[model samples]
Target: MRPPDNRRRRFEELYQANHDPVLGYVVRRTANGHDAADILAETFMTAWRRLDDVPAGEKARPWLFGVARRALANHHRGERRHTALTARLASELSAIQRQPREESADMDALAKAFEDLSDGYREVLSLADWEGMSIAEIAVVLGCSANAVRIRLHRARRRLARALSVDPPGRAARARVPEGDSA
Candidate 1:
């Protein structure tokens, strides 16, 4: 049998080779950078624990991806609980980091607009635009038809446009003008 050190070195070699793809899989499944990093760590930990199951050659990437997918799902479920706890303890940390104090007012307004959107619209935008998933991937994640996703995405864009326009000073004035009324 191979020595323990040899088995470990082999596992390290396989892990190093497949790390990037595994990380990309985690990133795609997660909501943000930090969550992706956590999932990636958990994926490697699983790999280390189950090194014997990892095939030595061509199948390694897929095996790692499968492990990553399961880890990501667990991470997502845990994240929901963590978010609820964190919201009570410290709200808006991520949002505050993304937006400076000067822009906080506009950000707050924009956030309200986003919140006003229907759940379907919000989820579609979050998965497709914010999380950057492909329509096909989003369909799988949301358990919806692809054409349905496309239609919802279109309506969501229109709704967002309307919301933004209504909040803009000039556009708000124009929208309020009566038909055939001169500016």
Candidate 2:
């Protein structure tokens, strides 16, 4: 079915008069022919929807161009949103891929050495390193003086350092592995 003849004719007249100028306006401001065509179509659709708002004669050209300009701006905003989403997704994916590789043999050896520490050394070290507790805070947790917690923390670090020196983290796993061999 067709629109009433008058409405169809009015739309055709409007399109015929303003289409080339609107196309040129969109094309000059757009990145490519495809985007220009899309914006141009949207401009005409807006004009068709708001035919009563469109002016006559010389004013009509500027009015159509304004619609085209707004259409181009909407296209650019959508593109920016898409680009931002893509960048965010790529960063999240890279973080996920990099996490497992960080859980390597060095950390395993360090864990074993940490577990072998005596209870007192483990308590102080775990508070200071793992739990990120300050000496005063560790003292509160362990019911001791801050000065005592500090001394215990120092001795705990020394013991862990000596253990690591004897069986250095990553040394046994990485040593003698041939280049380009994953095993």
Highest TM-score: which candidate?
A: 2
Cα error of candidate 1 at position 60, Å: 1.4
Candidate 2 ranges beyond 4 A from true positions? 101-183
The CA lDDT of each predicted structure is 0.82, 0.85
Model 2 per-residue lDDT tens digits across residues 1-183: 867888778889999988888888888988899999899889999988898898977899999988887888899999999999999999987866677766655666788889999999999988888789888999999999999997888777777878878533344566586899976
Which regions of candidate 1 are displaced past 4 Å?
A: 1-3, 84-183
Itemize residue pairs with steric clashes in candidate 1. none
- Using lDDT as the measure, the top candidate is 2
Clashing pairs in 2: none
lDDT: worst 10-residue window of model 1 = 166-175
